[model samples]
Target: MKSNINVVFFLFIWGFLLACTKAADPGSTVIIDPVVDVDYSDTSLRLQDVAPFPIGASVSFNHLSNDPKLAAILYANFNELVFNSELKHGALVKADGSFDFTTADAFVDLAKDMDIYGHVLAWHRHQGTSYLNTLVGNLEQQELLLDPGFEKSTTVGSPYWFVLNSGDPKGTATIAVTTQTDEVKSGTSALKVVNPTAYGTADWRVQVASNNFQTVPGQKYVIRYTAKSLSGSGIIMVSAQAMDGSGVTHYPGGDKTITGEWQTITLSFTPTKENYRIVFNMGKKADTYLVDDVSVYSEVAAPDYAAIYTRLDEALHTFIGTTVGRYKDRIRKWEVVNEMFTDAGEIRSNANSPAPIVDGQKEYGYFIWSEFLKRDYGYLAFRYAEEADPTAELYINDYGLEYSDKKIDSLIAYVNEIRKRGAKVDGIGTQMHIDIHLSQAKIDKMFQKLASTGLKVRVSELDIRITNSSTPMPPTEALLEKQKEQYQRVVASYMKFVPPAQRAGIAVWGVLDQYNWQYNGGSDYPNLFSTEYKKKPAYGGFLMGLSEK
Candidate 1:
């Protein structure tokens, strides 16, 4: 009776609760999601704002025009722009040795309110090499034939000259080596060929080809030799074949008759290719041919130093003065002379240079400006920059100074020496293209020495080389941390050692690590931005170093 009563009471209570709550009609009304607050104040950070001095970036002109994101980062961060290459000699000067500043002028136009830093006035590399070479002129293409007069050997041999063929009938003709006064020409020895059978019009039938000699393209070569025929006035065909197995034949003055008396045969032809073998075909008239005094010459002008010096001196004045004068209104700072000293602490000249005026060739890669102008090259560059803009802050810049005590000392000394000579060098830039693990002690020491000079000091071309391996590798957080630390340490050291007034500024070589000039194959972590244009840890680290939170 008690259980029945309890059950009835529970049922009644459950029914009453269900009646009171009617399960909110499924999906009848929807609830809205609440708006959340987020912070992105850090993303708005600009490097130029925190840095004490101008934060510069060596920027590419094409990227500014093509990549909007890259341009945004550039405009947002950097206050000064260093043209990656537009102002370079090779870029501005055409092959004809004339200035074409269309691209350079357009590059300056992108610097809206930003200062322009004239990269260089004089440099051996990135120069108009062909034009400079033309100024000096290449020496005559001297003798190409090893043994011009067949003087190397009295008999036919392989090393110097080789007689390729005997005759058409297999043994109808004999190639005899003789030093007889009647047979030989200028040299003591000569090649005497006796052909008894006439394989008329079959020029290659009785052939004696000389050993191959290297030929230059478009080089007008003159082959001069003395020849005589025993049978009066017999046709001896001379043809040239490429020794490189190209099967290409050059028959400029091939088919000609040799008189009974020894006569000089001059054959002139500009080669279309390289590696040529001279061929003599004497089977046309069944004659005994005596050939001697073979000489191959190319009429190339000798280098005239006086003329070269004059042309280049005038060219230097024009390149520097004209470029700076045009941009004087916008650019007030200039790197007057770059890389004037070798890593060995010695001044670079022809004696220390590899591209000295070569004997029979032209150097198109490097032109040592000091080879002609001597130490006065830098002096002249400074003079030219001063002449262009009297108020411009002129700097002499170089690399490898952080590690090389001798190099730093040499640069300082040279600057002092040049200043005495009336070259107004206003600053010195140490391109701190260092690695992450580069000794802090070395960096401090370098800063100390630079600070001692009392000239404006700049860390130009700042980038950290993560790895020494040429092969590409995946980047690691540890490596990145080290790069960040390096970037921070370098900045802090500049502030610690260099006086505030003398800090010309620290210019990160590139805005992004992957955009790094050195980052071709492998991953490089050198800049403040990642390859995706995202801010890197190095960016915060650099900001921290600038005394920013």
Candidate 2:
């Protein structure tokens, strides 16, 4: 009986071990504590709630527009949307003058309920170059002078001539075209210069020259003009002076004394520079001179600006009619003209070479546009933009305005000048693509100055970078914290400086760091979101800034 009982105990122990082994098997059920659901969304702040004005992001049309996560973030946080490149002139207008508004339309359709900011109506870089070239191709190959007769004038000054006086302290010299009908040599009018004060400086003379005349170096050219003195007989120095930013090089074409009767003076010389202005200098004696029918011609023809103006006007009208008019309801704010000046506060000149090609044709270089339209291009762009969308708020958008005080000053002057010319400019766009290392004082000063302009100011394309070089390393937590501080400071500066009425809004450059253009080949943590679409500290910092009074 004892042996049988011990056997049963052994069998029971073996069965219990087998049961334990089965419980520990891979397929065995295991109970765990219930996971406490933590909501990350509660810690997040809505951008629009913090911002006094509209909060916006520059969005790409592809995935950002449709992706559930991105769309959720954008829709929930932003009330305004600016397309990264969809609404640009190049994207909208095709090479054949036909518009492919597919991308732009898609963007508009997506953001139809939100406020849409049109990127640019006219920009030298992103134009439909092929269409623009086609408009001016024939004129580009030929040499022609504009308004040679000095007949057309909507204002007091002559259309194509820039009148300058040297050594006159009282500024008595004045330029006008005589409309008396009898003073003209060939046409109905003559360029009339009245200089009452005589200053004895050798360079002290009344000068009239063609503003946009192109001359080839080492190329022969003939200049002919008819002139007569009304009061005093004096020798008028005729020369072809190259008006390149470097000191003027005066190519002598000899001098001719003008009497009472109209005398035709012909001068022939080869220019030493590419851009030559045919200058007529009336010597020191104060007198009234009448000059007419000025003609300049080279063996190789130059651009005919009068005809070119017609084509350019047509092109501009077409562009405005198609893009601005089509989406007038959706897009009410436009960067009418963009990047007109460089960082040095100088008007950007495309004199050296043509801008990079877009759509298989050379973009409209700055020199070409300035030469054709003179300073009226900006005015005309604004005018047409206003005409297309009468309610649209127009802005002159430029980069480097924040750090470069001189650039901001110049841009202010430019905007004022455009407004003075009867063009409607509602705001100025300062593209604050800056580094965290930039002086906070300088940034504050910039916002102050911009606000002083009294026009609505928009901090367009706001991206703060921590890295300096294209080859970026993984940013440290400290560096990211610095970036967050900067982002907060920028938003706070904008809020404190920019008046509420004049606040056009701010647009973050992009949604993610991985997609930032500054991220050359490596990591650049510039944006408020990480590659995984999680909001970074900078996002909260931006919110904190806007939350401030």
Candidate 3:
């Protein structure tokens, strides 16, 4: 069975490459007579023997399902890694702050049940400030002496402590109750003891915490919430606190009146230190405080090449044995989640920071992306993906880890942050787009820092554009060679750090130049193959470099 397949594979690729190069490489273009038959009895050679995993390719879902042979061809030629934008965290978290685990959870379950590996989590934005307000309110309230450190006294004691009944001479003090075991029985039961005298002057003591401070040091996090006062009026205070070995520290806070109509609040913070806890308290002495959909989270980390690799593990398995099943393993090798970053191609900082990349300034990217890397979803997504697919390799795919120092620096910090939190990120992808003028030494040092975390590395997206900056496109041979050299240096540096077993692989963005995204130029024409499906000169150069001992 193996021998027959090998004969077929050799015949096909040999014929294909031969046909493709007939006009150029005359020595390799000699046409064999079709009538000359050769015996292929030995089935010893296998696909894995030639290439352990197939050279992978990236394709939109629409393409794979639309073409029957294309899927099989991908499975035969390479291992697969998929780019699924739907599994990102922003889409997963609901407006109420609790995760809308439906799609993400389904993706994970399908990976296990189907055996394809891919992303279970991504660094999409998640700001549940509305839900987080309530969370912080609860956390801050916990810090203060909200309950007086004891339950209500059933028997009468001092006037300061005795439970007062409705209209019992004392000024009316509204009290809210939250029944944990069961829903509160309303009417008079929910308001059994409202001190009538307690309300005249603000003498009663109730704890109030700031509703704002929400963060997780070195772990990306976000939270938001919206709630309505079902029946009564109450002053709600919320705040943030640091959870120390001793207890919570209340600081920086906010509050508002939760009117009967639903009120929405948003809270976004990245904790560089351990001060990422939120607390809340209700001021009404005797009002039933009803809360719903309280949400809390560390910030969501942006998807870098490293994280993309991690997510692919689950994606591969999820697609296995399904219509897209055969390409699962290949997809695990080199899948590109295009534009996973913000439109400007940078990670977002906290909510207050600008969206994605603001005006292409490195500061804007750093301000937001740094916060994201340090404490946002950087840790959580890795944790989940690691648990979901232990054997599958993963990467955080991105478009601009190459020429941008701010991006590179933040990425390093982000990688470090996740490492501190114990993530299994295996590599860093510098989506090679333009011909970067980075010093080899500087690039080497960056890899060294990333390697210190003990991860594999990759040049996830390798495109070279030499068109106008105003209207960017692919490059000419002269331009492409320079781009190729840039890629060669990067791949070379990456090879220095990665061990053979850990090396999943590297890939060109597209097979044909025409199909490549040169039109979106930052010096396009970076691909090793031309638009006509012919290997560019760089293709031979890369094959030689990659094959070097």
Clashes of each: 0, 4, 120
Off by over 4 Å in 3: 1-54, 66-77, 84-120, 125-347, 350-353, 356-376, 390-399, 404-410, 436-443, 471-475, 518-523
What TM-score would you give candidate 3 relative to the actual structure?
A: 0.43
What would the per-residue lDDT of candidate 1 be over residues 194-274, giving only the tens digit for each residue?
Answer: 888888777567777677888887978887788889877888777777777778887877678899999988888777778
The residue ranges of model 2 lying beyond 4 angstroms of the native Cα positions read 1-43, 138-300, 352-368, 521-523
Cα-based RMSD of candidate 3: 17.9
lDDT scores of the candidates, listed in order? 0.80, 0.74, 0.44
TM-score of 2: 0.61
C-alpha lDDT (0 to 100) for residue 542 of candidate 1: 75
Q: Judging by lDDT against the true structure, name the best candidate.
A: 1
Worst 10 residues of 2 by lDDT: 32-41
- Return the TM-score for each candidate structure: 0.70, 0.61, 0.43
Clashes of 3: 120
lDDT of 2 by residue, 1-549 (tens): 123223434565556557677567757554421111212134364676445577778878986756778787777777788888787767777778888988888788898467888887777765676677777754323334576777766223444777666336634677777887777777577787777765444534677667567776787788778888876486677777776776666645555778888888877888777787777777466777888877887754676778988888888878876788998877878888887776788665565334667775454532245546657777888888888888888999989876787788888998898888888999998888888888889889988998999999998899988876666768678888888889889988997898889999998888777778786555577888877888888886786666444
Ranking by TM-score: 1, 2, 3
Candidate 1, superposed: residue stretches over 4 Å from native: 1-44, 139-302, 355-365
Alpha-carbon lDDT of model 2:
0.74
